[model samples]
Target: MIIRREHAGDRPEILAVVKAAFPEPVEAKLLRELFASREYIPELSLVAESDRGEILGHVITTRGWIGAEKSLGLGPIAVQPEYQNQGVGSALMNATIEQANKMGESTLVLLGSTDYYPRFGFVPADSMGITSPDPSWGSHFMALPLAAHKPGLHGQFKYSEPFNAL
Candidate 1:
């Protein structure tokens, strides 16, 4: 299996993988919208592929602002249904974080399962002074600093336009 950055030709396959992995259209729609916008960071969108060259999973990071601090936010990491629990998602996630770090993004935030993200070093935003618009989801929102010993980053996280529309 190969973990690599997405190329121009990978767009359709990436969307197909997301559509197949998720039940809601919101995930797929947001992907398209983000790609269309100039804000899309090509280097942060990645896919995990099989040894035979099939995309097994995908992850995307986009421009986001947390109060006065600039950051990257991860989303819609979808592994093929048959490939779930097989480490494909984890591989993609690890690669994504590394790529984001290379791009100089200090932090990565997301709205996801609390149980799942903690394994990747993500913790509640409140611990870092980050707030979500939906108070009910405060605990589910997570953040991780790319650099372990960096200065504290704190603020209210404002998701991308596509996320806000949903």
Candidate 2:
């Protein structure tokens, strides 16, 4: 398998992978909306491909904010159904995190499975004094301080418009 930056031509395949990974069209639609939005970080949208050139997974991180400080929002990570549980999602995540840290990003937030994201060092957003706009998420809304934790990093987290639309 190969992990690499997604290209313009990968859109269709990425959409298909996302749709296959989830049971509904919501995530797939969100992916398309995000791509057209200013929040979309082209370099941060990554894809995992098989040796045979099939896209097997996708992940994206977009502009977000923790109070007035700029942060990243990670989400909609998806793996092809056939590739699920084979490390495709993990590889995409590891690569995305490494790239984000290299870009000097200070933090990342997401709404996801606590059981899954904790392995990547994500903790409850509230633990960092960050609150999701959606109150019902509770512990499922998580945050990870990519760099050293800062005093000003706490507050309401704002995701991109595409996420807000959901």
Candidate 3:
């Protein structure tokens, strides 16, 4: 399988993959809103495709902020059900992280499973003095410092408006 940046033509298939990956339509709906928002960072949206050109997974990172410091927000990572344990999601995630590093993003935050994201260097946001807008997220809110760690970076983390609506 090949991991690459998502292209315009991949939208419909991406949507299908996302929708099929989750039990609810919420994630798919959030993806659509995110793509249309100014916070969307095209370079950080990626797909895992098979040799036959079928997209197997998708991941995206968008503009976010930790107080005044800019950050990246990762979310809605989805893999087609058949491809879940086949490493498609991992490939897409690795590609997104690599691209974010190359683009000079200092950090990335996400609301996800602690068990799943720790391998990617994510830790509880509270560890860095960062709090999520939604209080209920608690420990599920994670952050990873991509560049050199900044001890001074601490504050409320804000995702794009579309996320608030979700």
Candidate 4:
């Protein structure tokens, strides 16, 4: 298996993997909107491919804001049903984090499984002074401070505009 940045030609396969990973179409629909939104960061969109060149999973982090400071919003990371628990999601996540660090990003935030994301060094957002757009998310809303993280980077997190429509 291989992990790499997503290409324009990978759209169909990415969407298919996302749709198959979830029971509802909400995530897939959100991905479509993110792709067309200005907040879409091409470099942050990544995919995991099998040795046979089949797409196995997908992950994306779009431009967002932490108060007035720039940040990243990670989401819709999905692996095909058969690919779950096989480290595909982990590979995509590690790649995303490495790339974000390479790009000098401050932080990456997301609403994800507490069990899974913690393994990636994600901690409760509020603990880092970052508040979720929805208070109801509580601890599930997490943040991973990157190599460029600073002590003063905190405030209400505002996800990309397309996320507001959800």
| Candidate number with greatest lDDT | 4
Write one digit per residue (lDDT tens) for candidate 2, span 11-69: 99999888888998999999999999999998899999899999999999999987788
Residue range 1-166, candidate 4, lDDT tens digits: 9888898899999999999999999999999999999999989999998889999999999999999999999998999999799898899999999999999999999998899999999999999999999999999999999999998897999999889999
TM-score, per-candidate, Cα-based: 0.94, 0.97, 0.96, 0.98
Give residue 20's lDDT in candidate 1 (0 to 100).
94
Error of 1 at 21 (Å): 0.7
Per-residue lDDT tens digits of candidate 1, residues 1-166? 9998898999899999999999998899999998887668888888898889999988988888887778877897999899999999899889988888777787888999987999999999888788876778978998888874255677788877788888
Please give the CA lDDT of all the candidate structures: 0.85, 0.90, 0.89, 0.95
lDDT for model 4, on a 0 to 1 scale? 0.95
Candidates ranked by lDDT, best first? 4, 2, 3, 1
Q: Which candidate would rank higher by TM-score, 2 or 4?
A: 4
Clashes of each: 0, 0, 0, 0
- Using lDDT as the yardstick, the better of models 1 and 3 is 3
Model 2: number of backbone collisions: 0
